[model samples]
Every structure is written in C-alpha cells, then in structure tokens.
Target: MVMGGKSALQQSAERHLWMNFSQLGYYARGKKLPVMVRGEGCYVWDEHGKRYLDGLSSLFCVNIGHGRADVAQAGADQGKQLEYFPTWSAAHPPAIRLAERIASLAPGDLNRVFFTSGGSESVDSAIKLARQYHRVTGNALKTKIIARDIAYHGTTMGALALTGIDSIKEPFAPLLPGGIHVPNTSVYRLPPDRTADSLAEAVKRRIEIEGPDTVAAVILEPVQTAGGCYMPPPGYFARVREICDEHNVLMISDEVICAWGRLGEWFGCERFGYIPDIITTAKGLTSAYAPMGAVIARDAVAEPFLNGDTSFLHGFTFAGHPMSAAIALANIDVFEREDLLDHVRHNQDGFRAMLESLRDIPIVGDVRGTGYFHAVELVRDQDTKEPFSPEDQVSLLGYLSDELQERGLIFRADDRGGPVVQLAPPLIAGPAQFNEMEELLRPVLHKASELFPHAR
Candidate 1:
C-alpha cells in the first residue's frame, strides 16, 4: 500500500550525483531512486510524496525522533554566534558542555572525549589512539589489534582492517597489517552445550593463542549488529571484561548503534553491566540532524596522554563542528526533558513481546536484541535452526527487502546471519508503532517463504 516514489528528482540525482555504497550499474539502468525529501517524528516522505515508517531510525540515529524545533534552533543560534571553529588546541562552549554531559553518562571514569564526524571516523580515531597510546607507554609491540569476527568497526581502510566481515573487505586485499579477529560470542554457532562461561573461555583461549602480549584491544558491540542482531548469552560481557583484565587487552565497546537510549541507557556498556577501556559512539548523538561521533577513553588510556612527550597524533577536520556540538547538546536536553532513557526501559518489554509474536511465522528462527534495538532472524528450518545458504540469502533479501518497503517499514536486510531484519526504531517508538510493525512484518514474512518453497 505505497506508491512507487520519485521521477524528476531521481532523474536529476542519477545524472549528477554519485551515490556511496550502492550498486551503481543497477541504479543507473532505469530503476529510479526514492529520494527522501523530509522526515517528521518516525516517518519520512519520498520525492514522489509517499510516507514510510523509519524503522532503522535512519541508520540507527534519531534517538529523540525527528523534526524537533529545539534541536534545530540550537544549531541556528550557534551558527549566529560562531559558525566555524576548529578543535585543535582551542576549546568551545558547546563542545565542552557536550563532553561533560557525555562523561556523566559514560561509565567508569571514561572522561576523555575525542570527537569525529560519524561512527566510522570514531572507530578509526579510537583504533589509532589505542595503537599510539601503547607505543608511547613502553608496549610498542602490543600494537596488534584483536577484534570480534563478524564485527563491523567502520569502512575506512584502517577501520576496515579491524572489521571481520570478509565479504565486504575481500576486494580491498592486502589491508593494514597486524589486525586479527577472535571468534565472536555468538552462542548459536558455538558448541551445542555451550554455556555463557564456555563461550567466554573460547574467546579467552583465542586471545591466548594470539599471545596476549601482542594484542592491543578487542573491539565489540554489546549486541552484535551485523550477524543477525546477535545478542550474547547472559554473563558474556562480564566475562569478556574479566578476560581483558587478566590479559591486559583494552576492550573497545562500539556503541554506534546502542548508545543514547538505544539500550535503555546512555551507553551500552552501562546497560550490559560492564566497563570498557574505550567506547566509540555516533548515529543518535544529534538524532541524525547533524553528523557527529566521539571516542571516550577511560582513565587507564587517558592518563598516559596527560604528561611526558606522549602524543596520539591524529584527528578529523570536522571533528567537533560547532553546529554539530550545539545540536548534540540540545539533543541531550531533549533526552533529559522527556525522560527518554526511562521511556525505553519501560517500553522495551512491550516491544519484545510484540516481536516474539512473530515466532509463529514459519521462517522466524529467533527474535533477539535489547531496549529499542531488535532484529528478527529468519532461517530455513525453525526447529533445527538451519539457515539458508549464501546463494539463497541474496534471493530472499532482494525479494523481501523491496516487499517490506512496499509494506511501508524501512529496516536492514542483514544476510550476515542467513537473513535478518534489523529493527532499531526511534527511541520515541512505543506500543502503537510496535503493533504496526508486527502486523506489517507477519504477512510479508509469510509471503517470503513462498519464494523459497524447497527450503521450508
């Protein structure tokens, strides 16, 4: 029940603009791109003027929802005062306030905030900082990085080296050196009788095999985003923390998608009841109205940078844009005024209940995630929990993704886990929106099975 979007604007963009992360050949061939003109609350309208629900929060940003006069006005006011100022050695009011506010939200003396333009930049910055920090502190050989398999750090060459998805990085061969990957704590694929303790042990053993003295950090998402919205069994994170403590590996919790009330807390580290040495965040910082990202370092890492000739030696030009900082501060005000964190904690149970109802759907193998972020993992066999092969994955996503677009809900078709539909709706999403999502997904999911009759 949605109209096919765009005509003239699509024609113009196709001719003039080069889109990023796209199948250019297919897009250039006659298929019109749906130009998103504007967003309000949880919905966005296309160029042809058809509205669709923003289930992914426009890339898991927009925590406080959309079209807020307060956040927008803060940017305008800051622009009037001082529109452009670099964050070299000089400091600004908005950036200072945002840093203080974020420090308050972050756990365990994670006081240092290094700003960036977006999540990828934050990852890249954090990694370089970790590498340099160890080099200056007499552990230069500890420069090797160990991140989770199937983990997505970022897209930049440096960050991409840390990423674990081979499919994405295969073309960019001979990547940066010494970046290693340990098995993720995804219990579904592990030993049949694996408990939380065993999974943590497996990760620790892998770290030992790599020689802990050589490893620098372990970058992880509190709930894995790429591989079908994978959530670790309980006690997984606490044990990871313990292993890192015993081996002296820095734990970098990538909260790009889980921060800012996404996990019913300011940071996913706090929500999951563990502390990480470094935290990378973006997306929901200014509710997607502005691009911004930050790397918060704990006292252990920041202390070394305080004195001596030690220097991290890296940063971005638009790291802390005045408008972005000002807008982010305003966004924080909105979180406080509306009690958005508590709102997420209150509503998450209802949201999970609604999603669990889809378990009856033939292809739904599992429904997992936390707070405002969740995903439905589809499989070929529900009981045996057998996933379709890679070839079948393309067919399902190509068919179902567009079908869901027709159903008026926008989400991620993550084939990283057979086929998963990632849902990180705006923090403003509640029972009403949850019900609508379930209603829309059920029939369409049922129809998806029809295309793969042999599998089921």
Candidate 2:
C-alpha cells in the first residue's frame, strides 16, 4: 500500500508528529516538514523526489548505507521464524548468535552483552552496570560518573546526567547525582600551552577532586561525537585508561556514534588504543534498519553478577528482539562482505582532505575529527578564532541549514559546539560522494562568508 500524497503526509506530520529534540514551532512557522520517502546507497529522496547526499548517514546510523534488501530480508525471515520474545529469563537463537558475534568483535574481554533498545538505553544500562559492578565488588561509594564537558551521551535520566551539555540538561535539572564534567579534548580551542595531555590531566584531576574512591567510572566517547566530533588528543585515551586503572574506576566507552565503520575500527576505543571496561554501542549495530543497542562489559565487570545470584535489574522488553538481532547479524555480514572497515580506513584521508580544503572559507574556523565523522567549526574571524555573535549564530546556522538542504545536501548544522556543520556520510560513500558533498558545501559556505562581510 502506498503512503498518502505530499499534502496528506505534511498535514499528518504537522497535526500529529512530535519530533524529538525539534522546535515544533519552527515547523508551524511556514515550513513544511521535509519528508524523506526513499533511500538508497548514500542518498535519500524527499517527498518531492529531490535527492540529497546522506551526509550525516541519517543521524550517523546508516553505516552500510540504505536499500539493503539482504539486511531487510534477514530480519523479515527472522520475523517469520519468531517475531518477538522477551530476553527476561528467556533465550532466543538470534540474540544468542548475535551476542556471540558482538563479543567476538568487541575488544579485550568485553564478552558479556546486555542488549537495549537504542543508544540512550545502552548508555543508561552501562551507567547502571558501572555503579552496580562497583557495588557488587564492594565499592558501594563508587557511584559517580565523570564525563567531558560538551560531550553528549544520551537523554535518559542516568545517561542525561552523564551528558555534559549544559543547555540540554538545563531544563531537566537535578538529574541523577554523581555526574561530573571535565574539559573535553577540543585541542583547537585550548590555549597554546595546553597540549592534549592537559585534557587527560583534567580527567585525572576531576577524579582526584571527586575522590577516586567515590567515582565508579569515567564515560567518554573515543571521539566526542555531539561535541563537534572532537577527537581526543594524542595519548589522551591511553592516559585516561591509565587514570581509570590507577583509580580503580571503570572506563566506559560510549560508541553510540563512533562504533562500526564510523571510526574505521570495530570500536572507537580500539582506534585510540584503549580497552574500556564497558562499551555502550548502538546506531550502526543494525545500520538503523532496526533499533538495537548493547552494553559490552569486560569479564571483571560482568563476573560478579554472573558468579552470584545478583541480576542486572535493568532491561527493556525489546532489548534483544529477534528481528533486531537477525538484522544485526546480517548487518555485520554486510560489513564483512563489503569490507566497510577497510573502505572507511582507505577513504577517510580523502574524506578529511576534502573537508580540510574548506578551510579556505572565511567562516570555516576549525575542521576536526577522524574517520568518516567530522565537523567544520564556524567563526567570524579565522585568525582570532572569534566565534559568531549570538545573532550571527542563529542567522548563519538557519541560513546554512536551509541552504544546504535546498542545495541537495542533508547533514547536520549544529550549534551545540559553537556554529558547526557535521558530516558522517555512510561508510560506502567514496570519492564520488565526497565530490558531491564539497560541490554542495562550497557554494553554501561561500555564501556564509558573505553573511559576515565585515570579517572578510
């Protein structure tokens, strides 16, 4: 059965749909919802049949790209076999097999997998596991979590508490206690004397100030995704690992947007050369074809509970749905068959260079990030590194966001870390896609330069 026409879809959306993290009033203010109808490879077509490069990989989840009939069929076949089942006190073949596969791919002894519905749940589950792991191991006071400033973990109470973004957490004040924030690894913004070591040192200092005995774990994205794709400084994660180890605190790697082929590695921590005790993952797990997330814990973290009668005490009904597991299995197969990891590894340099070339744009302040994930920070003056004024931020981001989409490029124009444009194209995107991205971005960025003519 075909979906309704454009007007019906738009009306239905405006009348009923409540988009997450969206300004609904903006939609009411003379803007029709851009309804995407179909997707294939690195592009998605809007209701009007206008195709745009899937630059942000549909919120950085479509790792293998869209239109994978094989992946869909795998889930469909699983549905036919067993549509749904609760993981509580029960086991299913798809979940069992997928868990084994994920354990195989996960780094170190992170063998135990606790499935969740999505990234936020995975994070929340990890946070609970961290606290409970310490408590089970007799460090009940170790319930605090340390995260970097401006980092985005998730939106659930526990996860949101761990999130370091002030604006997001402001409205929902008095969150779960014990969530501490430290300086993120935005080396571009640091003083000339502050090296990457400073960022790591901040973590160590926070742990010390918080009293390491009271801190359960430190959760960080290998490359901070929501904080402008900020890649950690050299030796940052290694030192962070050392600090966590020294303090007897677990290190939780939140790879919601960094896992799979996004970082040219199975896990982002691997890309940075550290083994976190708990790894939270989602997004690319099933390439956004199905919703699934997992908290992969090291042996020590899971051992206490497994050895005793203590249960995790937290789970979702659809945590390890058979269909999601089956699709995830097929997703991994597609990754291996297509060599998505190697594809990203090989193409990232070109991808990065294409973005780096945009440094010529006057408004483009700093371009940072690794692998397929990247962001272009905007500023009024490149020399001074002066950020756009509050007025300019609103106007520039609005203009760029609208212009880029109008020009057939669909990515994120985020002000979460100043005015920035982030791109995380599908892993399958190559030179041709890179060219298209630059083709659309260059003119829009050029226009952005014209907006702040005084700076030019």
Candidate 3:
C-alpha cells in the first residue's frame, strides 16, 4: 500500500465531486487532503496514522465524542423497528418522546418542538413558521426578517436570505425578499461610544428604516459564531427585548451553536435572562451522533400557525427521523448522567485562565470565549490592539495552524473572527485536556509570531 496513493475512488473524488463550503481551487491542487479514518473519544486518526486531539469537536459537533456504541445501536434498532415514517399525519414514538423532552428543557412558553434534519433545515423551517405566524395574526404584511450582520442562520434559500454575511449571499444573488440586516451585539467590535442602548437603537433604527410593519422577526445567535465567537455584552439582550416589544417583532435567539452545554448552560438566552419567541439549535443535540436539529417556538409563535387551513408548509423528509431522535434522546441522557453542564460550569475558569495565559504572545491580541467555546484573536500590536494584515494572516496564520496540528492539537484557524485561532474543545474536556491544549499552543504560537517578517 503506497502512502496516500491515488486510489481510483480518491482520484474520482478529486475530478468529479464538488465539495461544500470550500475553496475548491485549493482542494484540486491536493495540498492537504486530511482523510480522517477513525475517531475514539476526543481524538481522531488521519490516513497517515497521525492522531490529533479533536479540540474543535469536528466543527463543534460530535459532542458525545467518537465511537459511542449505544448511539449506533439506537440508530440500528430504530432502523429495524421503523425504518421510515412521516410526521405529517402520524408521528413516531422516538420523535414524540424527544420533542417532549426538548420542550421540558426549554425555557418560558417555548413549548412547541418542530424537528428538522439539521440546523439549516431547522432555521429554514423557523423562518417560514415566523412568516406564517405573522400572516395568521393579521400582520400579513409583516413577512420581513431582521438578522444581525455577520450572523449565520443557515444556507438554504430562505435561511440564507436571513444570513447577515453579504459575502456568502453575494454568490447566490436575488434570494428571498424582505430579509433585512441589523447591527449585531458583538461587543468586541462595538464602536468606541457604543452603549447597549445605543446598539439597540441602531437595531431599532434598521427596523424603522425598513418600516417595522414589514418586519416579522429578528434572528440572532446567543453568541455570534461566524463573526468569530463573539460574546454578547451585558444588557444587550435586555435592550433588544425592549426594542422587539416596541416594534412587535418576534425575537429569535439562534442557540444553534450556543446550546446544549457549549456555553455552560442549556441555552444562551437563559444565561442572558431573556425569552425569545423562537430558539433554533443543533450541532450538539445528539452529540452529533445522528443528524438532528430542532426549531422550538413559544406559545405565541406556534398558536396562530396551529388553527385553520394555514400551515407552516415546511418540513424535511428526514425531519425527526426516528433513528436521529432516539440517538438525541440518548445523547441528552449522557449529558445528565455525566453532569456535563455542571462540569462546564466548574471548569470554565481554568479554561479561561489557560487561554488568557496566551496573551503574553505578541500575535495574540485578545482571547475571548465563554464556557467551553473560546478563541484567541491574533494581532500585530500587543499594546494598541492591531490585527495582522490579510496577506500576513494568510501566510503566517496558515503556517501556524499546520504547525499546531503537527504538534498534536486540533482547533480552528478562524478567519471568520478576523484572524483568530478558535479553541472549542468538548464539554467533557477538563483541566487535563486544557493543559494539553496550552502545551501544544504556547510555543507554537511564539514561534509563529517570530517567523512572521511583519512581526513587531
């Protein structure tokens, strides 16, 4: 067996397969094709037999870690008992059970559970639901959605329109109409005089500018992800709620990345002490054991859509698949049994401290994250807080990421957060894993900074 040889399968994949959400030119050149063969616990083995820690949890999924036989068995058992069913007219037991459990865990009047295949589907579903809810309540003209800049809702046509990043939307021009943009609560990028009230005013101004009567809902992540793991400032949600109430616009807390122990809480909105009309989540719901996502609606968001001939008119074929539902139930069981939430609460300080220790490195400008999710923002200036230029970021940061990987750590070299190195280990990770992460990063980052010709 030649090392990483071009099997016909691999060769065909290179020539024919169109990969999702990637820079295809780079892929075609065969620079780095990391073929992850197997995973056990918090680590994975690549094709070359190199084992690296899955610090990013395989794109923030895989919450239960790899190789959970119980979850696999659940899927198999569901496949045998009921291979397929639709929730249109009839529902399966697993779906029903999981929905009730999720409803129980959710806060306030968010009692309805609408299932989808994944986060994007769930998000796409939520938008349609919001539109219908407004139409039913005699706010027929209120079909517009307001999402924050740099926020990512989903990639489906409906969901993509609500996504705030123009870069993603630019390629797919002339998407769904009435989707608007608002200023996000990324305090990291908050203006010099930006107050919570002022930011809220900025949001309110967008709604007003678009004519509040046309707006149906405002969607946001509890913590913005694509903008590079930005945390919400204190009083941000409170002010937003006030603005939403004033505008009669439904507020959506997109907990897709922040829910299920990622942020040391059940939901970020809960931690922030506010109630959103809808909460969308995925990624960790089943610990990524099975593909599953959910859109939860408050009583008000659901009640209107329930009566009459009007329906949300949206659902995925695999939505609430029995196998995924059962696996999710088991994943939740594991969370409770292991007391993972409490674990996150207790150990996050050590995580914070460990990451803050990296601030001494010249390239590390700011290290900000919450609970288990964190990122080290790399920069040029240690004092004035300047970022590396784009070209330097490409060469230096790119080189550093590979070096860190070679040293046996796996995290994100995130350009989404404006030249950051994202560190989001599993919730099960504790002081031991934290120490290992620091060990891998400290020297590698120092070396990377010195290697940069642009280094101050």
Per-model TM-score, in order, reads 0.96, 0.97, 0.95
Q: Model 3, poorest ten-residue lDDT window?
A: 1-10
Which stretches in model 3 have alpha-carbon errors above 4 Å?
Answer: 3-12, 453-455
Could you say which candidate leads in lDDT?
A: 2
Task: Please state the error at residue 318 of candidate 3 in Å.
Answer: 0.8
Tell me the whole-model lDDT of each prediction, alpha carbons only: 0.85, 0.91, 0.83
Q: For every model in order, what is the number of clashing pairs?
A: 0, 0, 0
What would the per-residue lDDT of candidate 2 be over residues 1-456, giving only the tens digit for each residue? 123434777878878999999999887786768989999999999877889899999999999999999999999999998999999999999999999999999989999999999999999998898888889889999999998888888899999998888989999989999999988888778877777778898888998998989999999998887758887877888898999999999999999999998999999988989999999999999999999999999998888887768988898999999999999999999999989999999999999999999999888889998899999999988998988888889899899989988888988988877788999999999999999999999999998798764376
How would the candidate models be sorted by lDDT, starting from the highest?
A: 2, 1, 3
lDDT of 1 by residue, 28-137 (tens): 77666778988898888886678888889988898888789889999999999999798998988888888988998889899989999999999888888888877877
Better TM-score candidate (2, 3): 2
lDDT of 2: 0.91
* Model 2 TM-score, 2 decimals: 0.97
Candidate 2: worst 10 consecutive residues by lDDT? Answer: 1-10
Which residue pairs come into collision in candidate 3? none
**lDDT (Cα, tens digit) per residue for candidate 3, span 1-456:** 333655454555567878887676875676555667888888888767889888998878776678778877888888899978988878999999999999999999899999988888878887888888888888888989888887888899988998888888999999999888877766655668776557667878888988888988988887777757787777888888999999889998888788998888888788789999999998999888888899999988878766776677788888899989989988889888988889989999999999999888887877787888888787788676666777988887679767887887888886754687887788888888888888989898888888874346
lDDT of 1: 0.85
